[model samples]
Each structure stands twice: as structure tokens, then as C-alpha cells.
Target: MSKMIFVNLPVTDLGASTRFYEALGATRNPHFSNENAACMMLTDTIGVMILTHDYYRNFTQRPIADAKATSQMLLAVTVGERAEVDRVLEAASAKGGRADPNPAQDHGSMFSRSVEDPDGHVWEIFWMDPAAVPGDSSTVDA
Candidate 1:
């Protein structure tokens, strides 16, 4: 059996968040979806469960930090190529999401773009070429 990762997030609106995720090329897994939450399947191994604030609050006794004010985590996902990175981020931006709130970064072998969801969750879409990684460890700047 293979282990699957589920990224749970607190959203203000399930429907809107579902639309936002769908724009980013994720499909809702109806089998695990309900009025309180939507299961967005990005890949067979990776999935995101966007739950309403009330539903998510039940999982933690600590106060939920407003994502817009404080960034708790940055969700980074790699795509196949540089073009794909742009495709996903573009769709996110078109659907009432934001793009690159921070400075854009491009390290020759890797390119990364960021987007902020309606709830202010940061998603970083990046592409990397394994062969491009510097191999001489000793020579690398410490």
C-alpha cells in the first residue's frame, strides 16, 4: 500500500475554494466531500481537504491564525516543466487569486512562482531539473 498526503486547510467558503482549486487543475473527490469541506485531488498521492473555519477549528484547540495576516505554511508543488508552472499560477490568478505577492525567483535550473488563494494560503509552483543541481559539494559556498 502507498501512503497518501492530505493537506488540510481552513477556508471561508467551501464552494468558492473548490472553484479556486479546480482552476488550479484539481478535481473535487466527491467521495470525500460534503457541505463542510471539499476534497481537492491534485494527484493520486497528493490531495487537499479544504474545510470551513468551523470544521477545521474542531481539529485544534489553539486559535486559528488568519492566513491573510500570518503565514503558517507555504505549500510548494513541483510541476513537469517551466511552462506548466506558469499555467497553474495563471489559472490561480485568473480566478480571484493573487500572484507573486513576494519577489519572483528564478535560479537557472529552477523556476518558482507563487500564488495566494482566496483565504491567503500560499502555493508555490516550481519546476526543477535534477541534472542541473551542482554536483561538487566541496566547492559550493558554505
Candidate 2:
């Protein structure tokens, strides 16, 4: 079976965060969703788990970082084309997310933009021409 990834994020408002992800074209997986958490599937293999701050604390003892005020990590998603990157940033902004939290990156063969979710988590949406990459062809799809 192909490997899958599930990124968990702590959110202040579960419903709003869920809606934001939906606007980005992710589908909610009811089978893995409930009052405290919602599993948003970005693709067949990539999922984002939105958990309430309280619930998220169950998995960690450290204080939750206020994503809006601090930086923890930057998450990225790659689309099939350059236009899709712009489309994603627009959708994110429409759903209460902050668009272009960081400057957009354009390197001819690649393009990327950043957007922050309602909770301040940054997501970088990008696209790259596989043909322009120097690595083995098998590694280009990611």
C-alpha cells in the first residue's frame, strides 16, 4: 500500500478550521471525525487532522504555541499547475485565512504562495515543473 500522511493541527475553533480546509478543496472524512476533531483529506494520501486545543493537549504536555503569534513549522502542499497555487491562496483568504503571510516565490520553473489558517498555521501552496528538476524522475512528483 502507498504511504499516507496525516498532519495534526490544534485549532481554536473546530468548525471554522474545518470550513477553511473545505474551502481549500479538502473533504471531511466522517469516519474519522467527531466533536473534538475532524479529519480533512487533502488527497487520497494526505490528510489534515483538525483538533480542538483541549483535545490536542491530550497528545502533548507542552503548552500549545499560538500559531498566530509564533512560528512552529510551515506546511506545504504541491498542486499540479501554477494557477492552482493562486486559486488555493484566494480560497484561503476568502475563508478568513490570511493570504501571503510570506512573500510569494516565483522561480520560473516553480511558484509558491503562503496562506495562514484562522489559527495562524502557515501553509505554502506551490507547483513545480517536474521536467526542470535535477533529481531522479521518480522523486519529482513530490
Candidate 3:
């Protein structure tokens, strides 16, 4: 069997978090959702489980940190093109997300920007030209 990934985030408001993810093109997966958690489908193999703070606490003994005050992690997403990267950043801002917590990055073959969801979880939206990969002479296009 293939591997699947599920990123779990603690949210203060499940409803708001659900709307936030929906704005970013994620769909709701009813098969794995309930009152305390919303399963957001990012792709066939990837999902984000936005759990209420109380619900999330059940899984960890440590107290949940305030994401608004400190960053716990940065989740990255890739798009087809640089324009699409910019597009998602803009879409994020329009949908009540915070954009550009850090300056944009350009590494010749790759470009990336960061956006934070309503709950302050950072998501890196990026585009990379695999053909232009650096240091891998065998695969990189001339």
C-alpha cells in the first residue's frame, strides 16, 4: 500500500478554519469529519485535519502553543507555475489569510512565498522548475 499524509492543526474555531481551507481549494471529506474536527482534502493522498483545541489536546499531553504568537511549523505546497504561486498568495489574502510573513524567495529555478491561514499556521506556496534543478547536472536541462 502507498503512504498517505495527514497534517493535524489545532484550531480555535473549526467553522472558520474549514472556510479558510475551502477558500484555498480544499474540499471537505465527510468520511473523516465530525463536530470537533474537519477533514480538509488537499489531494488524494494528502489531508489536513483541523481539530478543535480541546479535541487536539486529547492527542498530546503538552499544551497547545498560541500560533498567533509563535510559529510551530511551516507546511509547504507546490503549484504548477510561478504565476500560480502568486495567485494562491493573492487568493489567501483575499480570503482573510495573512501573506508575506517573510519576503519572497527566488533561487533561479525555484520561487516561493508564504501565507498564513486564519489560525496563523504558515503555508509556503511555491513553484520549482525541476528541469532547472541546481547541482544535479545529470537531470538539469542545459
Would you list the C-alpha lDDT of every candidate in the order shown?
A: 0.87, 0.93, 0.87
Model 2 poorest 10 in a row by lDDT: 133-142
| Residue-pair clashes, model 3 | 0
lDDT of 2 by residue, 1-142 (tens): 9999999999999999998998777999999999999999999999999999999999999999999899989999888999999998899789889999999999999999999999999999999898897878566453
**Model 3 C-alpha lDDT versus the unseen true structure:** 0.87
Q: Worst 10-residue stretch by lDDT in candidate 3?
A: 133-142
TM-score of 1: 0.89
TM-scores across all candidates?
0.89, 0.93, 0.88
lDDT of 2 at 55: 96
Better of 1 and 2 by lDDT: 2
* Clashes, model 1: 0
Badly placed stretches (over 4 Å) of model 1 are: 133-142
